[model samples]
Target: MTENIAESIVEAINLTKTFHPKKMPAVVALNNISLSVRAGELTALVGPDGAGKTTFLRLICGLMDADEGSLRVGGMDVTADEQAVQDILSYMPQKFGLYEDLTIAENMTLYAELHGVPQNVRQERFARLLDMTGLAAFTGRLAGKLSGGMKQKLGLACTLVRSPKLLILDEPTVGVDPLSRRELWEILQTLTKQEHLSVLVSTAYMDEAALCQTVHVLNHGRILASGTPEELRHIADGRCCDIAPTSTMPTRMLQSHLLDDPGITDAVPVCGKVHFITRKAGGGVAFLSKYPELPKATPSEERLEDAFMILLKEDEEKRSSNIQPPSQREGDREAVVGVSKVGREGSIDCNVEGNASADTDEAIVDITVRDLVKNFGDFTAVSHTSFDVHRGEVFGLLGPNGAGKTTTFRMLCGLLPLTSGKLSVAGVDLRTARTEARRNIGYVAQKFSLYSQLTVYENLRFYGGTYGIPARELQQRIREVMEEFDLTDRADHVAGELPGGYKQRLSMAAALIHRPKILFLDEPTSGIDPLARRSFWQQIAHLSAKGTTIIITTHFMDEAEYCDRMMIQDHGEMLVLGSPSEIRERMHMPDADMNAIFIAIVEQARAELAKEGRKPA
Candidate 1:
């Protein structure tokens, strides 16, 4: 068996899946897709939303028979012997259906019975899984009480009630925190190395995909490329370069402009520089020639994302995901600045330090939270949080699962009454003008928060009217926003049926319908592809430049780099608050990227907790 470790455990030949709904065009999910997965190895399938990843997995699991081609799992024909194939694979989907009302042990027992595990071996199997997942001590806890990471771990444990030769996970770390995500990958590695279990995972994160032994990039129901990490990265070799913008140039603003160049395939902020990819190798210098005043481009190491973008860009049928820059916004919504002490590690800065600047002036306060606190029963979700957001500045709030980000957001938006605090948003005091303040605040949630059943236009009109726009002005505003957002073609499409990127666009359109001065975005770009995420940032940068203050919460550390300043909180207390440069300086990691610095800060806090003999939050 050891000698046969490299044998193919799953193989697909000319595989195809199509859906023909009544009166609708046929949706081809897979077009002659072919791939091979070796036994006891890790493989990854990565793609943008609606790229047929879920459909492909479903076909392999025998949940849906392919319209054409053939597939074999564990040497058994999946279509010809569906049950035999299902018995050898465990599939955990994006939204694993865990019985939240039941205890961990009860949930495991139920899944064991459904999977037909023998009663005699149930206890031993459960014990092993519980121990492996660090959930043994919480068997009596209800699933609903588990944290986001713990719930995902429990779902994984339940999938292993009856061990299978292959384990399939669909974006298991989508909304999980970074620490938990790292831990989960460690668990997967242990399973594959120690138990010799073959694993297949689909992810939107290139970093995660890069860790797998094999990677397959898919789009429009077709595999664009497939190979080992090194082989795939070779596609973008010598094409990647970094442009250190002049000291006067803003990083994000420079990136937004560079993305417009036809020769530049991709542009993103990396470590205070604008890292970009050229459409062709040796074109970096040529692209830089377009911007004569900019510094010379330096060759940078190639990355999986650069390769992914090149493959997607080579396809002519790819949709144009650009968001046109908007005109400057003129408003006088600034408020009184909050007072707090500065220079203390976790204390609020009572005053804006002179010489601090972003795209706009930093002295004018837009939102202020003074001694904010929120308690649900006896549990304090937010403990005396205090901070000030400046006009036109992009401020971010980052924390682990169950942290006070959402709670603080609700208070700022006037959705939830604070237990005790002083807050002001959009020049209106919550103590006096919450109703007026609502008229000037916009919010977009991480997931689809719009009316899914309504058309895009209908949703926009609804929000416009609700915000008290005149009947005549509402239509004009709606048309203007649709054109700006490039959603004219999908105006009549139902919100729920749109692809993930379009869904996010629709949500943003609805939020901006009233032209609010303050925008609150809750992990707005999560689960989307790199292309769409960059496009979204372009729009955000444009808005910030136009003098709109943005307050957001995100788990993606890279996204945090886009903020003018950000704060990281855990266990209802602020740990660090500073600009990206300030954070790197404080950590004494001049060369460390945002992701590394974030992990170090969070892990250091965890280590301190361990040293104090307390459980890490």
Candidate 2:
């Protein structure tokens, strides 16, 4: 079939969608938003969680109808010819359901048959997609057996079984690792450049959105700004700068302190320093003068993230709400809040133990993974990995998909059995006496693991009971957690229905119910927006300050900077381990950002393996 391409492949004019729950106030998901996806160009929808990016994409795909305005896909009105529009476009939702039972090739064939892709063209397309996604050799693997990144790749391939004029992806990189995320974008860019395909994608990562030719910044179901990234960047041109915090204050605490300043727009940790944006174009220097505690500002180039934050901050100021930002909430200021400490004295007694309990002042090694190894029959998941997590230290464990980081974490958390190694938490041996050791550990999983059907308060109570808290103590702890985490308003709300930020807070609250000495946060801030992330980090800062040993795994390179120490492992092997500065120095590039450093290390490792005629598992 021949093709006809319009200058604007997709267009929306004054589009709006609202949801009205039976007993609640209506939510305006999209409010008269207008945008255009230019033909043969990469377009991005940038927004925080609950910003209506998904709602807008669904409207374009005709999966749902907008309450008002017009949407045209490939110059065809979606409402009038939804099927035709869909036939010429592919919409990849956040959770693209790929049959896990089938092999990768089988899944591709199934999608091809469903799309009526004739046998003649099926092989060619499958080959092209597999090659493009770097999954050609993995065609025989079962979908369920593949890693997260591989599954996403196969999902994308299935969506493209029959090439569409326009490709719509809703946060396709949401949970994928940096390596896979980069690969996914490379595919999209090639589709736009080589095949002249128009691509529209929504992303939580500012770096990903900045790569787009056009970006529409969304907030509260409205287009806050729409322009090229350069134009958006100019929004904070003279307002952005980096300031080193005083030796006395922590970077995260400094960020929280600065956010309270009226003249400051946004403040976040960047490479262990505070990178902030001011209210006006030239307001950074003036704003710094007011805070004698802060050092002189070093001007930095603006970024799409700085611009997005400024817009969101400005918008929040115009609207009033009963719920206050976490930073402004007075209840959780102290790291050592209402939690009653559990004496680790009865737990592990080895000299190998030490994360101080909330009541203690000694900082010692909290966890030890000595020659840790995990294997699934023939596959070694974590090969002889070892690390020590000190009390009150924030340690980051990062790796690409299928890189053994998750395996290492599972072993540490005692969720999985280690094939061989000495594992210790709070000085208690993990290999034996897991039950006793678990008492001193709190784990927040990558995904929301709370009971969605239950209310927030109920979830907290359940976790407290699970942790063996007495009825009287559990009730009091629940109240304390609710107050400390600012979840009082959401206590009665169903866990599943809560927004991303609240859900995260609920998870943390549930985890903190036992007040475990070691906290394991597995990608806790994966899909949340920047504002929520800042608030989350502040909470983390508080927890760490109070002698909590935090061992976290995340896909966010920027967040790695927040770690006091971090280790990168790939293909079941340790690649590098050090603080941010130490890592940069090791790479011999003093100014290299975490992303660049990560890519370099992983690539170099893979290259060396290739030279030795071996492929990463």
Per-candidate Cα lDDT values, in order, are: 0.81, 0.82
Give per-residue CA lDDT, model 1, range 70-137, as digits (tens): 89999999988899999999999999999999999999999999999999999899998999899999
lDDT of 2 by residue, 313-407 (tens): 77876775554554545544554232212211112121212223343444477888888888898888888877667777788889998899988
RMSD values for the candidates in order, in angstroms, are 5.0, 5.1
In model 2, the worst 10-residue window by lDDT is 343-352
- Model 1 root-mean-square deviation: 5.0
Per model, how many backbone clashes are there? 1, 0
List candidate 1 segments past 4 Å from native: 1-6, 21-24, 285-295, 317-362, 612-617
- In candidate 1, what residue range of length 10 has the lowest lDDT sum? 332-341
Clashes of 1: 1
